[model samples]
Target: MRARNFVSVIAAVGAGVALVSGCGQGGASGSSGDSKVIKIGTLHPMTGSNAGDGAQLQHGAELAVKKINDAGGIKALGGAKLELDAGDTKGTPDTGQSEAQRLVSDGAVALVGSYQSAVSANIAAVAERNKVPFVMDISGDDAILSHGYRYSFRLQPQNSRFGATAAQYIKDITKSKGRPVTKIAYLHEATAFGTGVYTAFKSEAQKLGLAMGPEITYDAASVSDLTTQIAKVKASGANILVVSGYYRDGVLAAKAVQTVKPKLDAVIGAADGAFDQPQFPTDAGSAANGYFDVNYHLNDKSAEAKAFADLYQAAYHDKARASAGFAYDSVRIIAAALERAGSKDPGKIRDAIAKTDLNPLSLSNGPVTFDEKGENTAGLPVLTQIQDGAPSVVYPDNLAAKTIVYPAPVQ
Candidate 1:
């Protein structure tokens, strides 16, 4: 029941206090009566374009399971060991659905991950039908929780929250720089994740009375070059460009800026997508230097969050990813739920997850609590700029790693 991790929740792991209240030793699962093992399935992309992200998320869950088992597993379940049942989504919806079935068939009482919004939706459906408890690590599309399912819970903020937060960040950034962001341009992928963020942001922009310009939506998969889309952004004469998409598309968008070379003050983002991933700087080179992305990130200022960032970076041999922490926390949360429920029955696990309220050791955010819709009520997003190649937290004042670099010199 230790609350620790970063995107799939991202950060390094460090020292933290013992977590969660446990029910005295009891049988966690009917199957565990003999094997004394509680299985949790980790569903995420292990192949395809988002494979790198999936791999990171998978490792996060692996580390959590290791940490839990190393500490004597679930004490309430007669010290039953936690077993991770890993499944590959292959970064596709159909594959994701199939994988969920595979995991459930293998006797997983709980599940975590599958990063894409679309894929997560598919897995969520399977988990719901099978009556398995699902903890979604990272898939921000708002509709995931709108279906009124009782079994699935999200550990991150909804996509709509990202839009409103980004709009407010834009206003603050412009005001600090003494140049008001008047006209705004919108660019996003056509997928649910992309379109959902943009739709919410557009509504927020309208409320702010900002003049809207060209809004371009394109497929992130086939659209390698964004000249056709950037052309519209350029012609719109907007000082700010708000983009939504994943890493590959974000790189294309940044390159498009180089190709079209718009005289833009800033190109902010709704999703970490391209900017927050480690490969972004290496992929985009100098172009990623000035780009700022707004997404959920670790508030490393807290001792617990700092501990997690260190642990994740050291264990993975790479800096913590934007989504790693949540994934890690999700697994731990499920494990804690198992301890609280004292039963492996899916319904009991789901009930325990609903009452979870431990402070996450992964990020310096709010306590881990769920609303009626199965969304984390404490989830908060962060703004980051690619400062010298790595994402540096720079917003919300209290958790900032560095100050915002207004008008980052065009590379």
Candidate 2:
């Protein structure tokens, strides 16, 4: 049976236990009643290499729950408060799946999480099997949604979208600056996350009549040094170097580029994790300057986004990253689903989520809407460049926060 409808079959069997146990009453351990509180699960790597990003995702969801509750909770459900049951995946697929199962068993009607694509895939399966709605906050690999699971949804553009957009942005910006396109070197982590992006980027770059070569790969978890990789890129005679990888490895690649001094026209990132991060400049030091990344980012021009960012900063004492914005939106989407469903039943919530049509605070092409595959067709990514020690949107003219700086100055 379809996961969305499958929940109905089990709802009856579970209702008695739910009522007797008062699920999610006391932090999902046991509480007052389902009418008083609705529980949602947040899965992320809380104590691993990606812990930094995971914490932001959790914080964003927390802030959204607080915002909704402060505004009087879900009125349709008689002011029922939303509770978050956070689970740490430790950046592993096994742990992610286990945690997802635990959260649903505890009482989460809907779930959001797992920054890494692989981890998200595992959690997606758990959600599907348990007949709970799974909303992705930031996992980008397109294959995650290729399965015909109706219970899973995504708020971010797929990796292929990020790659193609990056290629187009590079072509436009370079040509506009009178530099035009030339040879490009690609470096990415050897994982579904990085490889998925590189594959699409190379195809799109080729389609745009841009030359690509010197593709390099490294293990994000074990690789500490990228000097050898950067040296290959420098020798490739490529004028543009495109990188795709996670934060720590991305920072390592930046430092390698600095040490190697490739003298490329521009060192850019295609769906790169570190290039668009708030802490990248501080972590990569001088190596971070002039780097560009084509990926999803917060719409700084949106008044709502501005307000949200301010609140996030005041609460966390740190600038909100794009990943956090998605997390916040995920929670809001769940709340909207809860309000619309008017019931804590997982089946009803899943159906309501499938019909979501709401404006998102993130930089999107249009109001959030999901296709049959649960991909947010309205989702879009923007190009950002680290200028003046901070990343700023620099492309798409409409969302440009700063003008393009082409052929980056030599360090």
Candidate 3:
């Protein structure tokens, strides 16, 4: 039986290589025996508020599955190719619950995403009920792991850690220069991700002995203008601004800050809404420079980072975004768990996933090992500051690419 399995594995690998090499193979063909296909489900917002980033994440995950299948899939699973069953979450929690149920009912061995925290929270029950391992690629709600869901796994760093990273970076920079520590204002959307960051920053600031400014909350959806919110933040006489929301609000906040020209010591935030992507820099102008923020992985040129970067660029024809790395790594982590289990059973897969210790650069916030609560113990969020057009890590010395650059308030 072992000999027969070895032969099947070799045959599958050869077929996969041939297909990748552009030989006369249309696509991956299954062997005529047990372990036919490894079906996984992805619940992502193909359309809705967070669609821009969510769509990119979905594509990255799809690309990872394609590459895995092209490389002969899982040899231990009798050369079964990875197959993805994706559901459009519509970026809402209500839709997310229905989609999760549908995917589990359809017999998916594992589940991948629901980028928004609201969506993830709504679908988490379904995944738990079916014992399906839900790998979160984007949602960063603190309650995600705090609830102690055994089957839930998150590849991204927690929201609270990210908030702390950003806040600490500012605190360190100010202390080093002996600047007056006046006030810190926190801005957050009324979403789970936003609220998590808001709470963490407030707590960390108080611990650091920084004055906590009036915390401001905004509606993520339908908040076209942020004049009032910005005015309130400026009135607080805060030296630092921590915006904990999505990209749309980030743009609005940047514009509003420029118009008000408040005396801010620093402007930073958690990674959720802060990358200088597309036209953010062009739109924000000088405000884009020296903007401090935090993200899950660094876009370094190290070997591991390069390997994933090259493959991602080759497959997608663009630089991988923050969420893309999470999606790709989430699939890879799930794949490793499946390989270890040697079975499609969700219970075993969940156990294996909790034991994974990957060093993939695509998920460099830290090690991939998860504790019983499904939170990664090996990782902590990194602080970054926008220089030129990209975000480079500046905190956690080992992973950092450059020294921390404090944002000098425009005189």
Q: Considering every candidate listed, which one attains the maximal lDDT?
A: 2
Write candidate 3's Cα lDDT for 1-411 as tens digits: 001121232254342331111111112233222367776778877666666666567656765676677777887788777766667787788888988887787667898887789899877878988899999888888887777788898777788887777777667778887885788888889888898887887778778888888888988866887878888988988888878877767878877887787788667777656553434576667767667667666357657567666665555445666677778778889888888999889999999998998875543544678877787776556676667766677676676777766545632
Clashing residue pairs in candidate 3 are: 239-265
Candidate 1 structure quality by residue, lDDT tens digits, 73-123 = 889888887766667787788988987887788678988987899999999
Q: Candidates 1 and 2: which is better by TM-score? A: 2
In the range 212-269, model 2's lDDT, one tens digit per residue, is 8788999887897999999998898889999998888889999999999886999889
TM-score of each: 0.88, 0.91, 0.86
Which of the predicted structures, 1 or 3, would earn the higher lDDT when compared with the native?
Answer: 1
Judged by whole-model lDDT over C-alpha atoms, candidate 1 comes out at 0.78
Model 2 clashing residue pairs (backbone): 25-31, 26-30, 26-31
Candidate 1 deviant stretches above 4 angstroms: 1-34, 361-365
Q: Rate residue 179 of model 1 by lDDT.
A: 83
